[model samples]
Target: MGMEAYQAQFADHLPGGGPAWLSDLRQAAATRFSSQGLPDRKVEEWRYTNLKPVQAQLFALDAVSAGAAPPALLESSYRLVFSNGVLQSGANDLPTGVRLAGMAETLSESPGSLAAHMGQINAGQDLPLPALNQALSRDGYILSIDPGVMVERPMEVLFLSDAGTCYPRNLVLAGAGSEATVVEHYLGRGDGEYFVNAVTEIHAALGAKLRRYKIQQDAFGASHVATLAGQLGDDAHFENFDLNLGGQLVRSEIHMALAGQGAEAALNGVYLLRGKQHCDNAIQMDHVVGATNSHQDYRGILDDKAHAVFQGKITVRPDAQGIEGHQLNKTLLLSDDAEIDSKPELEILADDVKCSHGATAGELDETGLFYLRSRGIPEAEARQLLMTAFIAETVAHIGHDDVRAVMERLVGEWMAQ
Candidate 1:
């Protein structure tokens, strides 16, 4: 069914307590989606990536009964599982002193808190996929760390897609002087065609420290689109790493605002693509205050006919002096048909700032390959070794030891295939 039919058919079934503001927000988002439709290549931001694969498919609400149990997960003190866009509380465990609840439950219990930040990141935004998520989201989670509290363990959010279409919206808040780690994991289970559109909003108050990781491994037959937006407070620290290695067509957009003096932010990602896969990573860093530091680093490995795109932009406001901003993107093309488009941008209006951006795309070094083969290494093994070393630099930026190890292992598994 088209978006209009789907909206008219599933409006009543949407999760809510019939609040007027919530209803009005959903209606407005739905109308926006209908009027704008899906983004096309004509759009400047989306010019390099074609989204026809998502637009051609007819999406319907996923059947709850169709969901299978979640797969085995890594060890974490707390984990939340969402299957086919519905949170499965029966399978979750929470850490003490940390507030965790589904979006609907949070709205019912603490509507005022959610109301203040629910749609702040994506509300009335022009992004198509995020707009759709706002209009028809069925389930997600909210996590908050109490002020002056330190969480000793990492939190995990697992999203499993069995079939059909699912939209999940998540929010995370870190109180002042708090510190914590969060991991968002996505996995797909069936050969059935499906779509996953996800959105996440995060906020870090003054003196807070937040570390976030996004790991996506969807089914080869599915389509995935996601957006992550966050704002940092004075003297706060925020770091995020994205690892994408799945789905037929995938796009990940990340936006960060450095709104606080002395705040430091780091955004990094690594993606591996093969066969007919396509992935795009678009990142924007906004320097709204002086004496802030921001960095963006991304790497990609493309094989066969796979394609990838990286667009990184850093903007400094006129009043934001004494800023340090750097952006870099590097890619390795392993096949003749492999292709990548790399764009690095810097828009600086500040007079006293240090900012630079660059991008590089190329294939394996013939000289290095020859040297490895001369040392008695097989050609395939040699290629894998070089690729691993190439990506290790970016992976080292991940803060948590366990998470970094898991991501390294995942890259090895992909190389074996």
Candidate 2:
């Protein structure tokens, strides 16, 4: 029920006979997690979201069998399926310049390959969830792209969970002048209680372009917590979008650093919460050099007794001149009991930087709803139309057409509910 229970399971959960560096990493992470324990409201970054529910229950680290099948694969995309934190299937025919392998297998055969990328982005962070993930994670994927190569098809990784708890760690490396798109789809199979703690690290080299999308459709009884940490090199572009439609309690965190000049990063997300569901989105963008650009746009729709929180911060260093940073968060409360807390912050140490942030939480526009109803549309239909239009603005930023269409369809389904 507390940190002790998790610590008790550490030895049993750890992978045996791996490289010494990996073992040392896991041991260090275990020590850190033990010292910090599960974060509470006292922690500044986790002030709005509570982890008591997750800490109250002791989840099994492994499942006896896999659950139901995952969602249908996206058309013409390379797919990798993980059920209950174990690799179930993989694509046989990958692109020429792309290499995708499971973390467990990679560690066994070529453990030294991960020494450079793993934990490099999130080093020195006092985050307990990520530390716990690093200590216990057993199965995930490692994707690498060669320089100057363009991946023709999108890569999809589907994480399917049924019961118990699983820690998944993922890494992505994009070489110089390469371009690719990746999708992370998390789905729960049945109405069972479970927990998923995931961490993903990304590194984009100079002149590389990477687009990442995440769709969280966890079960109503599940709790999900995930962090995505990325670093961009000179002239590199990184784009990320998240769609949260399920999970009883969910926390999605994104941390990005523009470490090189001319780098760009964009973070966009949409969350639809109802029936007492709670979702939190925490984002941080750092401009470490000159001529870097970063943007954050997030929108949420809450009904019933649902609650949502958005915390976004942009920091421009003293030497980071000519940096452009902007953040905007908007929430539509469909019911009087629904609530939202939004905090947008800007820390500009450079006088030559242009940084701004804004947040708004209110009900849908009455005038737009009235106009839609005046056009002979029913009240429910008019409300749906208005809400759809509100979220469409953020969804338009998705670069891939198929992913965008799937997200739109999922939004429509959630609205219909």
Candidate 3:
């Protein structure tokens, strides 16, 4: 089916009908989705995981739990629930300097603040899900920080999907010299097949430092894709950590552009899969100017018949000098049928730049396991320790201890249980 036709199909049947802005966004999303369809395995970037299951299932773009409120998630410390893709409760009580309002409110109230950046990024050029998100997505929230402001608390935005699948689009902007940390967790409550098409646009202005932590804990029957698109100005920094523990199929695209010298960006991901679930982490970073740095580290552990995919490309333009970039991917296949495919690449056009990438796929190291056993440590605890240490290299770089503790605890619990 055509992108437009698919989006048109969705628009023609939207539920939980809202105000006018949502309707307008739907029209625009339909056009975008129509022009750009689902990405094929032939697309060099998505060769590892086939999305045939998603197409076969044919989920609705908007999954609204209208009359049925999401059951209480007692285990979740902080959560933001979105039934049918609309911000439910929990948003009304955010801390100061942290604003969570619908996209419509931002466009109307902070037009000057959001117009320049809204929908400006289209990773859809090479990916289809992003385009579909652009087309069928309704209103999500916008989080902004004032210049020179430092938000001490780690804000949690929990997105939940219920019986119906839904689309969510969110925008986050940090002003120059600002510092903040955000945690965006995607959770599903029921055993329904839903789709979470989400976009998080970030702008790290001059000298600003921002940290983003994304957790996807949807039900086994759900599928989701998220695009983390960020633009960093001079001396600005953006760091992202993604943890995928649920979902039948999950994919994430992270694209970034460094605007000025001294800017830096980091992308780190950990995907743990079991059963027949598949996960993909695709990324692209371009150093358009000079004196910038970027790093990417993605690791996966597969069991049962699980599968994983990773594609990374770091480009250094001729104009970019004194650039430093590195990418690495490592995977551990625990089962004979489990598999992982990785492509870590670097394209450099500048003579004065340092760029490198490496990828490895193998089973757990016997030497390390033996070393742990020699010390009286159990087999499972030893493997978990090694694996956590492998990922902790990236986690240790995080500036916020609270945020890191939460992530560490989550990973630990997953390993223990």
Q: Candidates' TM-scores?
A: 0.94, 0.97, 0.89
Q: Could you tell me the lDDT of residue 133 within candidate 3? A: 61
The numbered model that scores best in lDDT is 2
Predicted model with the maximum TM-score:
2
Q: Is candidate 2 or candidate 3 better by TM-score?
A: 2
Once model 2 is optimally superposed onto the true structure by TM-score, how far is the C-alpha of residue 174 displaced, in angstroms? 0.5
Give each model's whole-structure lDDT: 0.84, 0.88, 0.76
> Which regions of candidate 2 are displaced past 4 Å?
1-6, 56-59, 71-73, 123-125
lDDT of 2 by residue, 81-179 (tens): 888888888867987889877898888888799998888785324588888888888889888999998998889998898888888899999999999
Q: Scored by Cα lDDT, where does model 1 land?
A: 0.84
lDDT of 2 at 360: 88
Q: When superposed on Cα atoms, how far off is each prediction in RMSD?
A: 2.3, 1.5, 3.3
